[model samples]
Target: MPQSNINRRTVLAGGAAVAGVSVMTAGITSGAAAAPATGLLSGGRTPGAVIPPSDPRYEVLITGINKRFVAHPEHIKMIRSAHDAEDAVRRAFRQGKRVSVRSGGHCVADFTCNPEVEVILDFSEMNAVEYDYRRRAFVVEAGARLYNVYEALYKGWGVTLPGGICHSVGIGGHVAGGGYGLLSRAHGLVVDHLLAVEVVVVDARGRVRTVIATRHEDDPNRDLWWAHTGGGGGNFGLITRYWFRSPGATGSDPGKQLVNPPKRVIAHSFDVPWSKLTEAKFTRIMKNVGSWHEHNSGPESPYRHLSSLFNVNSRAHGRLSLYTQIDADIPDARRLLDDYLAAVMAGVGIKPVATTKPSGELAAMPGFLEPRELPWLAAARMVGAPDPVGANPEARVGLKSAYYKKNFTDHQVATFWKYLSDPTLTGVDSTLVVLSFGGRINSVAEEATSSAQRSSVIKVIFQNIWAFEKDDDRFMRWIRAFYEDTYQHTKGVPAIDDVTDGCYINYPDMDLADPQYNTSGVPWYTLCYKDNYPRLQRVKRRWDPSDFFRHSMSVRPRN
Candidate 1:
């Protein structure tokens, strides 16, 4: 194993970060429900399709989007409702089998597909999106994909949740990890509108049952609800469904309850080729990005309605892409678009090879993938299209992520230029992606929900992907080295500080758990949960005393 890049001087900083985060939280005022209700309620059991090794679907079901890990569980159970999920768990428990749950099958890590897993409760079949009249919120099943959720909410109720741009991400892990996307700049995270969650957990007595936890102050399981707000997946329990009702919304009309995204958006996208850009220009562009977000990424910024994604591709790919979107309904929407481009491209003299926009179609940028045609860029077309990841299942990937509370330091810029332009790792398509984060997102306090990374101006992800299993190690080493050099002074990982506020849970990087890679005494949990770890631990012990729901990074309860 390779030794971590941390020096002796930086190790102590991690301990100090943990010691101080206890005061990093605040309380959110929620409406009162009838009262706290504990349940041993079991729904009618219906046996779903069971696939064993012999079944044809088993091979496909065991394979997730990432080709890195594949499950060899004894069998996979297809689930539909809360009853189905509970039944699968109870059966797995009774048989003393290692259990894992799959939603949308998009987990980049091996949480679900590992050697020890004896059974996988596949929830992709449980997808259901509908408006709950009684609760006055949209009830989305855990297995439901982002595109389906958007289609149902927008077409049926004229509303949408502020979530990731990837159309196939599952509601279960996404919402639980504080999902965000283009609209997050204006509406906040997906969890910001979370009203309640239906979770199937193992009781202290080893009995399986379902609990409905809500943000309602009087609800007994309110802590559970808080934990899921940003606690990460496979931690507390199996989240079967999430109920979304915008906070402080009191109206009866469902259409008026949730956020109303701009019906039309102005999408501008362009690319800068490495062939025409210099290292100095790239560094200047990177610094300007941090400055622009620092000045404009706020709740009251007139540019709040604008969101942008900087797909700074690894130099091996030959080009960097910029995609910006703003509510066309806003006044001076065009000017907002032009000013953003000017600010980011200020000193960089390189311009797009050609500016292209369709005659009658909506122009847009699809993040995490190449730009799509204008027709596919339309909101409806974007949602209906399959995610490029799901569209192809041959690539293996490794990820490292960071949250920036301030602009990029000159040192950080140099690190990026060095890694992205490294000629040694020839032909590797590793990318240092910068997403516009923190607008209305920062409006909430650090501890208001489980998602503690609210103050960051931008989110950065270091991603590398390859086509063959044989090349996994080379690609992983390259990306890891790239990230290590960027935070070389900070114990090999992005430690909590003024410039960097730790990592995002949604982008789980197991390297943080390895002492060899993360010499920072601050443990993976601290880097992710911060001060909120203790509260999440208490909830873990209360709801899952035996720690029945667990994985490599699952919340562990103190005995």
Candidate 2:
């Protein structure tokens, strides 16, 4: 990993207090049912069930996966069962209060963890995953962590569900948002195999009902299952449990899902120097690797044994780094790797320093989720095919990308480079990362699951991480300018525009919704959902018409 020149002392010099709060207890108190001016219950609750401010559990409930956004809600309701969730929603709705439901607290925008929230329907107490060998499936509680689920499946049935990279992320939001990870390239998305969901629905009359939606194609509520695939969380009703159909199964068989865990999974990292390479060289490498992946995707392809991610980070400090990952066994892996490297070096030229290691399945999982830890301050935009232009002598920059398709045209490649090399941008990190997107991912259709970017050949993430929070305006301006410049460069260019699908939801950025940033009027959902937005909106209307569950970019109910 490239080290940042910005010192730790410099980051804290601004004295911005990290926002956080304490977890309230589970019990309720008297007069807590009164609705605040915001229409949400700001306080007052049933006696004997309230967790007062004096309780010890108060502190733990407020922190989240990011620890970036934290504020105490008026009240915290710890739900032990699906019934508790249903009841909580009903109370909040009856009081005309805005409610936030929290699963793992991984929400970057503080949707469920926000201080403005009056009622928090927390599911942390419901972490449980049960395997039914006879049915060849697992019923997982919403609060279950990815790691816990993995542990449970492997221990009880020697099986696992394909899901996100982080073990700490809650299944509720993860699956509701169309979870994907290492197994994705092989097993498809987590939702692709979803069998059923147990949700707490609040009717217009303020009555609570527990409803179940299954994968049965003939089920009337099949659309509910589709919405969970990628519709995102807080839109549909609160899902307490998810049932997953075991992959590669013939009727009921627990052992079917447990492929002999790879005896040895090896990883290799290649870091190329930005100073030594020209813009043309960088573009060539991106195009070559991208094309290779697109051509070799599907059940076939000579390099099917390998899964790789390529990224470039460009900064205003004149730093550039390109990184790639190849997943394969150590023996023949080197040869397969060389082929990729050669393709990258075809037109442009740069020799990269490579590092290789063998890791167990558990240890290797984190590698796929690597980008999550990078200091992210701004929202991200997804780029399909990127072309690297010559280095901008005036600006320090970094760039990175993930290739889903095998290749892009030279014109597409050039257009990408032009955007990154633009001047006038400042206070941003010079970095870029290109991740590998396709292998088994492409085999699934856009509608097959809620994750709609399946047609994209590349998933480009543009990020800027700087040292000072005070530099927020300048940094944001720089990144937004870069994004617009990139979009402008590709406008009307068939090869670039036609193939340049929008952005990723996980890399959420509110700027995409701003008319100033998104001149195309393409709402963020269009970038993330495409045709699936309308369906998601329908689900949102059906489950949360009052929009009780919402955030900046959450699915909105259509009129």
Q: Which candidate leads in TM-score?
A: 1
CA lDDT, every prediction?
0.76, 0.56
Which tens-of-lDDT digit does each residue in 12-93 have in candidate 1? 1010012111111111123322222122112222457899999988988887878898889899998766767777888887
Over 1-559, each residue of candidate 2 has an lDDT whose tens digit, in order, gives 1111222112111000111111111111122111121211122122214454567866656655434346576677877665567667778888877778878776655667677777777776677566533234566778877666665666566666656545567788888887765455555667877876767776565557666666666555677777888788887788877767744557545556443223233444455554666777767777676777666656444354455444454423343333333334435655666676677678665665432221111111224222222110100001111111111112222221222333655655665566555555453343444555655666678877778767554566665644444555666666666566555644311111355666666656666666766666556677778788888888778766777778878899888
TM-score of 1: 0.88
Q: What does the lDDT come to for candidate 2?
A: 0.56
